[model samples]
Target: MGGLAWLTPRKRSATARSVLAGEAAAEAARKTEHEHESEFPTPGDTRAAAFFDLDNTVMQGAALFHFGRGLYKRRFFRTRDLTRFAWQQACFRIAGSENPEHMEDVRSSALSIVKGHRVAELMRIGEEIYDEYMADRIWPGTRALAQAHLDAGQKVWLVTAAPVETATIIARRLGLTGALGTVAESVDGVYTGRLVGEPLHGPAKAEAVRALAAAEDLDLDRCAAYSDSANDIPMLSLVGYPYAINPDNRLRVHARENGWRLRDYRTGRKAARVGIPAAAGVGAVAGGTVALVALQRRRR
Candidate 1:
């Protein structure tokens, strides 16, 4: 134990440094981009907002995957890219955790696919895709929760690792205040195939909320956050009210231990299944790949 004593502190220091860096990056993003605030102003509470996770929390599947499916339908990415997305989806579904390396792979692939596309073009398509594929997938319970916050006059925001464009579209459609998502670098309204910072996942998510709270003059103690995976524990811990909605096993345990509220919208059989098959097989060709790969191996 003594031999490893020096390494423990060094690791902790490194982690602390990484988290601080993430916060700084998110702060910069907030300043550069204008979040889409609600048009209908609320007068009840101006100092508090609710931050919600996108995938498996506000929707049934990964928002990014759904966006990828739309891109695939529009021939934005080739079959090769679809295969990688499927593998990543399978991995994410099975693990039920935000593995940094896995998310990095997805980020890199998404950037490459949108390298030369115009931001406006993608946003237009995203709207269409959301209507066709994502609109009905939203959980009625979760929708009601968000509506309740809106009815209370508190702003509601979506904080997700999905692309900012996609998240913003969803927020607007749902009549939320705004969304904070992974920003992709663009030049002249065209994507440059790069990110402004890290994906808004895990610790970075907490950093984003902190930065936004400071900017908006929001009271952190009055804020609330909701998510499904334990990966968002950092973000969940930032707010006064943290809810585990459709929580994974680890999050379920953590929420119970912390005396947090837990809500599960899925049945026992559905909960046992990762539900990656649909996301993995987003396209006809990818569907066949999922069939052969047997990603449902996790259900066993």
Candidate 2:
């Protein structure tokens, strides 16, 4: 009876009517199955999304390294461990996070050190660390770009390999939609010293976005994505509008080859290096914790 109500009298023969109704039902069932498989709504969502990679893409540098410094200052780990972390962060700065080995090492060390730490205490530390080390490091231009997406009513998400707690704080501070990061397994509200899965990077990052899209009914074809490193190419490729921010050599070449938009915030380094004042020094934190912790090795 769904579409059969529009039948003309001449075409309403009992046999024809049954066949027409069956065809209509079959089409409807096919559509519903497709929607379920793709996780798309029947009419599809009108809202779009913008996914931003953290670290060099949004902030100026490696975020976890900064948090490591806060933990080190609190005596969370030994001076030797901090030194090792600092060296890894140095590589991240110079090599543009192309080394999955360094990333996994940092992820392992960070999670391991947090074992047995109370979740509430870490959250508090995260808040304090951001205010002191991360708040000012955010690039004004990139921040405004995020705001533009928010203004347009698009969901703005931060995708990073850092812990979910850390990512949530950053997104909240910037009024972003939310964030997806590596999850550290916990029991009884304390760290278990292990990851629930692999760190979100490369193809893993794209998978995470697709999972989010399915959960939120987002349309990737209408979405936009931004990142600064070549390592994030998989993630950028997942969307229709892909922008390369402060892209490295590999990323620049790739972007150009694909005709992707590029934004270079590195020029701000000039004003930052001019010895202007506090305002200009904000750029320091881009490499702040990552660089300083290397020199801080002798503290112990």
Candidate 3:
């Protein structure tokens, strides 16, 4: 009986030692895994960046237009206001209007509509609107451009004047590295209808790109910038490769004067829009149709 009692203490000590050893091994393995993860860089960690503007640069029209339409449908904005907004935007498009007073009025009016809405509510609405309108509205050529950058192992970012929540949703869905956009401020969960930072447009867009480049250690000299508007001239000038995708008249003139490459993705050819051969257009249409069908099937 005494021997059995003496052996019991040794057995318990051995069991305790085994458990302690197992725990130590597990902790060591966890630490090793964490270190490995830290060693590998994510898509956003690249030293090269491809900055893309959201409106006519990536899609055919302004993202704000679609967002406003969605808001109108949801009763968050009045139909009459939406109509007026659309008309004003159309005029801006046609005339290349950069009147400060007109721009400020539009911005103020848009912000006033969501003055008291909760951030969570607005975010919910954004998600719903994204699924309904924004997702399918991605321009045919924009996704291909983004994918090409990804393939080249470059970090692709969406820079826009659209609200951050809305832009982030689209960026994430497209597997972009990151996004920078205007931020609407909230106080105690409700919106105050003011921006947290400068509105990401014109020179503001260039500033955001600079800040992002510095933070991510991206080399501006090796980066690319794409936009369709003359307002993006500052942003385009900041990068090594400035591409005008479906450029407006002003931007097209600037691009031509600077000998920058002009691409018309809408026509799906490497040639200028004015001189595109009929055969090339036919080939582009056929190829685009096949690619789109393949994309739809892949999504399904």
Candidate 4:
């Protein structure tokens, strides 16, 4: 019996070696095919550009919410406090009050909850959640818009404040060129809950877009930018064509004041109606909800 056991390991080792050789050969073939495909660009390429926001613009809700929920389920956060934290976020979204105190509270709480956790574990959890929930949560209209840009031979970039790793995964899934997002700092494979650079939010989003534009040689005046919040004003203004999709109260006001075109694809209809003025410079009030227009400048 001992002799048989020793022989079994040698047999298994031989089988493993054979399998690895086959895998390596297959991988090399796949790489060759991929390289060939990348060598050729499709004909009739008109170099236009488009920028999309992550939350509410491309997705139905904030990615952070789901990530937080996943962390809570993993016992990283107190189960009882999770609900309260979610409620606060909801309030912040609705009010657009920009309460630094509340923002810090949420940030610190989330950090405290996730402290000492390995980055790999969080990433694994995020991946599982993304496949099951995050991917499906994409807004239909947003997807269509992104596809249109790709079809038009335009470059599409996703500008977000989410972690770069998470954003990059989504971009790859969508077949986008790349993404610009906040990068979380890591030390020894563990998260520090601190950003490596500036958070890609508000004006910072615009900065990232500018950097991409310069790197890709994109014409900002000919590029299109889309967002749902007034906080995105810096980014939206940077592009020649600015679009406000399902905007919040502040953004609705800014859109109308700026004469930007409005679109609501949530109902699957191309927005065709100009919003009536609610307050000067603000969008028309509709059903107690604000509807702002998007702006696009014709290519001259």
Best candidate, lDDT-wise?
1
lDDT of 1 at 271: 53
Model 1: pairs clashing at backbone N, Cα or C within 3 Å: none
**Candidate 2 segments exceeding 4 Å error:** 1-46, 268-300
Give one digit per residue, the lDDT tens place, for model 1 in 180-278.
Answer: 788787889999987765577787788778888887789988888889989999999998888887778788789989998766665555554633222
Candidate 1's C-alpha runs over 4 A off are 1-38, 94-97, 271-300
Off by over 4 Å in 4: 1-47, 92-104, 266-300
Candidate order by lDDT, decreasing, is 1, 2, 3, 4
* lDDT per residue (tens digit) for residues 1-300 in model 4: 343365578675544433333233223223332454353232223346778888777776666666677777777767667886787668655653334455545655655665667878876777876776588877665676666566556666677766655665566567665566665556898878765444566656776776666645668887788887788898899987787876666777798899885555443221222243322212213311221112122432
Residue 87 shift from truth in candidate 4, angstroms: 1.3
TM-score per candidate, chains pooled: 0.80, 0.74, 0.73, 0.69
> For candidate 2, lDDT tens digit of each residue in 256-283?
8999876656555533332222342234
Of the two candidates 1 and 3, the one with more favorable TM-score, higher being better, is: 1
RMSD of 4: 16.7
Candidate 1 TM-score, true structure as reference: 0.80
Top-TM-score candidate index? 1
- Local distance difference test, each candidate: 0.75, 0.70, 0.65, 0.61
Distance (Å) between predicted and true CA of 206, model 2?
Answer: 0.5
RMSD of 1: 10.8
**What CA root-mean-square deviation does each model show from the true structure?**
10.8, 17.3, 19.3, 16.7
Clashing pairs counted in every model: 0, 0, 0, 7
